[model samples]
Target chain A: DQQVKQNSPSLSVQEGRISILNCDYTNSMFDYFLWYKKYPAEGPTFLISISSIKDKNEDGRFTVFLNKSAKHLSLHIVPSQPGDSAVYFCAAYPNYGGVTNKLIFGTGTLLAVQP
Target chain B: AAGVIQSPRHLIKEKRETATLKCYPIPRHDTVYWYQQGPGQDPQFLISFYEKMQSDKGSIPDRFSAQQFSDYHSELNMSSLELGDSALYFCASSSLGGGRSDTQYFGPGTRLTVL
Candidate 1:
């Protein structure tokens, strides 16, 4: 069940350019979305998140825009640095009354920022 | 700053062997999640626990079982392992009631290789 999908497997950008990564989900139960950055031999690091109620959330050079009607979300990194190169995974959590809200992940997009 | 910790960063086992992976969440986190990532693939959710109780389950194989302890740490037990089981296993944790509680912080991951 590929509820969450990242159509792009790889994205390449020059340093100081903007990198855009996108994700889509089919399940409307997902009320929380997040973007994670992962390096080889390590775990995923939380980069940014956007709640369903908000259309955009920004932190420094990172911005996440959510479009609930389209069931899509995108991550924008401005002035991409070489250090920003990594595999980015988009994850979503369904709204649940229970204490545990599990996440569904996309296939991931490998962003390469060329120096 | 504390982060999730997973043990046996690397493990090798035979097809029929059994293995147990451990996870220690960040201080005071109340929920834990388990994910498996095959080479060249995104992390797949397996199971989760909240307040030491099983809260959700995913595509985990029948030979696998997991539980949260009274201390809030979690363990995933895999029996009758197969070569396909070889992957990187990650553990993540989050608190239930903070502004950032919905965000998950991942561990370094355990690389399991079935021989």
Candidate 2:
């Protein structure tokens, strides 16, 4: 069972525009959510993250919004640049039992930025 | 800014053989996690260690085992590997010190092909 789901397999946006990638989850026990950007033959790079306690978190051009009631989250990149084109993955962290838990990841969404 | 390092970026193994993958976490980071990503699929959690002790377990097969050493590096040992085991294995690390403790940074990943 996929606890985290990225419904969109791919997304395209023109440069200097906004790009939005969505993710959904079935588990409420997840207390932390993160977004990672990956390129071909490279590892996923840490982007932005939001804790369950907060509804949103932002870092530079990247912003992540979380809706706990809906069990959904979205990563938004404003004025998207061509360099931002890559595979974006949404991961959920279960923070129960006072110890670190494994991350559950979504299938990922390929983001393409057109120059 | 040293990142996580994974050795033997690519490996080809025959069925029924054994393979060992290694991971070197960032300095001062005490936790490590392992994940496997099969073709066209999301990453699946394998196992994790905190401060040289096994802290959590996931969907890792019985044929696989892993451990962390005193220096904070980790290894995943796979025995009697099967063809289905071909995948991209990633190692991620995070610190409990401060500032987004739950966030994880991933390595370039080891691509394992079982023939």
**Residue-wise lDDT of candidate 1 within B32-102, one digit each (tens)?**
99999998888988988888877778899999999989888899999999999999999999887322329
DockQ of 2: 0.59
Query: Looking at candidate 1, what is the lDDT of residue A101?
Result: 56
Task: Give the number of the best model, judged by lDDT.
Answer: 2
TM-score of each: 0.95, 0.96
Deviating ranges (above 4 Å) for candidate 1: A96-100, B97-101
What residue pairs clash in candidate 1, if any at all? none
Q: How close to the true structure is residue A75 of candidate 1, measured as C-alpha lDDT?
A: 98
Q: How many clashes in each structure? A: 0, 0
Best by DockQ: 2
How do the residues A1-115 of candidate 1 rate in per-residue lDDT, one tens digit apiece?
Answer: 7999999999999999999999999999888899999999999999999989899999999999999999999999998999999999999887765544567899999999999
Which candidate number maximizes TM-score? 2
Q: lDDT values of the candidates?
A: 0.91, 0.92
